[model samples]
Target: MRDNIILACQTCKHRNYTSTKNKKTLPQKLELKKYCPFCREHTLHKETK
Candidate 1:
């Protein structure tokens, strides 16, 4: 099943995005390069618990 997760900016520790993932298929956390308004740049966003 798919689970909802929050993505936070690695550089500024700001919660910027939300997404869903399949926990059965992928066990590891999700990471992506996304735009952060707080930082005013594209930064690495990691899944937050």
Candidate 2:
């Protein structure tokens, strides 16, 4: 099934975006470097519960 997840900024702890992933395929939380307007720089974003 498809699961909805939120990507939050690691530094500012802001919810930046939302994306969906297949639960059966990716059972782990997602992480990536994304641009944050609040931080004004690229930061590591982690999946939020």
Best by lDDT: 1
Q: What are the RMSD figures for all models against the true structure? A: 0.4, 0.6
| Residue 12 lDDT, candidate 2, scale 0-100 | 100
Whole-structure CA lDDT of model 2: 0.95
TM-score of each: 0.97, 0.93
Candidate 2 collision pairs: none
- Whole-model lDDT per candidate: 0.98, 0.95
**For residues 1-49, what per-residue lDDT tens digits would candidate 1 score against the true structure?**
8999999999999999999999999899999999999999999999999
- Which residue pairs of candidate 1 clash? none
Error of 2 at 5 (Å): 0.6
The clash number for model 2 is 0
Off by over 4 Å in 2: none
